[model samples]
Target: MKRLALILTLLSAPAVAQDAGLAARDAAEALEAASILLDTAEDSRDRVAALTDTVRAFEDGLAAMRDGLRDAAIRETELTRKLAAQDAEVAQLLGALSALGSRAEPQTLLHPQGPLGTARSGMLVAAVTPGLAAKAAALRSDLEEVTALRELQQSAAKTLEDGLAGVQRARTDLSQAIADRTDLPKRFTEDPIRTQILISATETLNGFASGLSQITENEVAEVMPPIEDRKGILQLPVRGVIIRQAGQADAAGVTRPGIVMATRPSALVTTPTAATIRYNGPLLDYGLVSILEPQGDLLFVLAGLDAVFGEIGDVLPAGSPVGLMGGDGGDIVSLTSEGGGAGRSETLYIEVREGGTPVDPLTWFTTE
Candidate 1:
């Protein structure tokens, strides 16, 4: 009976060893299954089931697989914490992406307060599962792409707005400039200086046209009556007022011009048929003035003599010296010449232009 008991104990020892090994294997399998559950679980209910199953297996083989059970528990704890944190972060990321899509919000890379894409979701997955880290990187690239596209769209919108504003400003300024120019002509007409310039231009233009026809000394000589013969007729030399008759005054208010000779009341001034006379007359209030009646136009005879020599109706014999200066000065002359004379004298106011268009006398008399 003692020998039979010993053999039975040796056989039971092999069975006991086999049972312990099987328990260790089952514990390892439970740990692996729990890890997979943590990696893929989307909710707390699933995670709880995996955790319960793993813990039950660990307890069942506690005595035979203590070390393995401890290791599995540690792994499960770490994976659980990581997964929980990852889920929370993923939820936040999803919320952020949703907020970015709202239309009423202003534009921004993060929607003013949140992310613009689901790429952040991969970050959570990576925290819990190292094997998925590469996928997380790919998701990050997607986030960057969407962000860049949004920024480009916003930039384009701003550029178009700015361009329209610039165009409007330019149009307004151009209109103002046109208005300013239109008012310039009226201003020029009101200004004294500008009026004077107009007067000068008018004279220049008239003179250019007048140069085409000129009278000659021969014409004047032919028209003049014979001086030596008493039967010769006397014609009006110039048709105009005696603007200033021959006159003068002494230290006690004496006499001058007419004192020397007789002048007609109104005469028709004429020129010789073929003569060129450039004569400087007297120094009157109207400075040293002159008269030139060429031999081309018989009716054209320049006769504002600030200085006069020949008497009224006197035959000058064509190119002969008519007279000496009788400058309009002092009292009487000032009434007529005003600023036209040298210092202010009543001088001849000659205006004999075609078409009745009055011109500046100075231009026609001198080369300048």
Candidate 2:
């Protein structure tokens, strides 16, 4: 019965070992699947977690591998220390041998040929010879360990380099996404707040662009003369209805060589180009008047008129009619310079402009 029991126990041992091996294999397969899932994860936080788990698995997978490396380091330190100690002993032995050879009284230290002499010499040599042999063997082993450690460190460095490259790629993608978000604009890129400034700058540049290539400030002199009697032009100074016309000296107290005009009370006034109307309040003795700079050298007419026409600031061609002489035409009237400083009285109410400066009006007008 005892023999039978032993046989049964022996048969069960192999079966138990096989079951344990199968269980360990299953665990390893599961871990490998987990690693694959971790590698394929998309989320950054999840990826980091997976990488951590992978590192943990690697550490656990070959825990003995790490132990072996640590053991190698410890052994290396131990071997190095032993080698140093051996070298010291060898050095001491060499010194003693040297002293023996160089001694002047060598005869006193000499050992006669005998077993006792050989024994003493052997004792001194024994101090370093075996230790040196042991150190050489250990150094060879240490070189192998060093090579292995270098390989391991290289692998770690490569892994870190690859991981850093992946991180940099991710950062670049994110930055590009952000840049694309900010670059949306239909025309030239402009934020709402900056539109006004952009428009203003564009308008200012447009105004300058026309004259930029050819026009100069000095060219103003050609369009406007400085002297009250010199040749140039001036612009009309206001906008209003024509009330008094030029011509007809036979009408009731209203006879000026040039036109006398008036504007409604609500007319808007603005300076045209560069001009200065040379007049105080009630001018020409014609009633509230001012002269305009001339258009160009042009003919002047007289005596055939009926109504007061032409408003202030009215841009006129060379022979534009001022107006007919007198017909009702309320208290509204303005007289402009016609020829010289003479207009019924010797009062000169002329406009002037030149070179960004104002010139005289009567200079350019010719009498008709």
Candidate 3:
């Protein structure tokens, strides 16, 4: 009877173990499916955000163009007034010269032959010649003023035209971005209240920087690829030459731990890698600035933009357009040591930080 009981227990144990194993496998499969769904949702949310940024960028571009046009018009009006004044002066001088020319013959003015000729020549030398010389000088000055005014007007007009073209390009790009993401599902929406707070907060950069350090981000279980793996492989956010490198001292004698790039007017700025926008607005003396977080404990600071696209918390993919550099409208002047000046339309400042410590960005980008 004891032997029979032992055999029955062994058979029951095998059946129970098999049932547990099957249940564990089913649970694992369910968990995997849920993870996949979560990933898909995040992807769709990012797409919608990117599309929204594109639309906002287009709107901003149009507004900028309008502002530029208005400025151009004002400048042109001023130039026109100056030119008109110069034209009147030139006309007056020409009229005086014409009257003098009509009264005297060239031969009599140049060489007198008799007593009447000698008297006329004395009169010409005493009064007419001096007046002519003065009028000619005035005419030359007026002509120079007119020429300068014309050049200024032409430059203003060209700037306005370029701004219009930029707006149209922005519109087309916005449309394309919208179409590309139309099929995506949205899992996240922007919080207007939070965004307003960020925009309206008139705090110093140090204050904002401190606040940023305290904000916690939602954790995703998936591991992010390390930035270290992409050393010397990443492209620059903008196409330009690096004018200032990290740890260089500026004119102010303060050491700067970022890179400064010289770019063309209205050049587009993009993300070098996938990142979440930490902040986007004016910060201190940097003008329009953008702060991005690409991975844990890493942040990128981009500054000196005229217009920015994404809001805080917006996720952008690698190489996604974020904003454009402010154009000089052919009016910017940078003084040099030679007592001359050059046009520097835009300057982009880039700073990288790892755990709040500044790091050299040249090690990460393929600047060539």
RMSD of each: 50.0, 40.9, 27.2
lDDT of each: 0.32, 0.33, 0.57
lDDT tens readout by residue for model 2, 1-368:
22223223323333322232232233333334434544554444434234333433432322222222233344445545665766765576566556545333635434677768866866765575566557555555555544443333333233323332333343233333323332211111213333333334443222222222121122222243333443335333222222333443435774433443243221212233333221112221233333333322221222122222333223333322232222222211112332222112211222233332332233443322
How many clashes show up in model 1? 55
Q: What's the C-alpha lDDT at position 257 in model 2?
A: 35
lDDT tens digits, residue span 1-368, model 3: 22223223223333322232232223223323333333343345554344334433433333333333333334435545766777876677688677667466655455447778777777866676687778686556544444443343343334334434444454345445534544422223445565456545746444455456334344334233567788678888875567788988888977777888876566667888888777777877889999877776788889998878765666677776677788733332222211111233478999887777778888777876
Which structure is stronger by lDDT: 1 or 2? 2
Give the TM-score comparing model 1 with the true structure, all chains together: 0.16
In terms of lDDT, the best-performing candidate is 3
Q: State candidate 2's TM-score.
A: 0.22
For candidate 1, lDDT tens digit of each residue in 194-257?
3334434444324422432221122223332322231113222232223222344535675432
Task: Flag regions of model 2 displaced more than 4 Å.
Answer: 1-112, 173-368
lDDT head-to-head 2 vs 3, winner: 3
Task: Compare the candidates by TM-score and give the number of the best one.
Answer: 3
State TM-scores per candidate.
Answer: 0.16, 0.22, 0.46
Candidate 1 Cα outliers beyond 4 Å, as residue runs: 1-293, 298-320, 324-346, 352-363
Query: Can you give the lDDT of residue 200 in candidate 1?
Result: 46
Residue pairs in clash, model 3: none
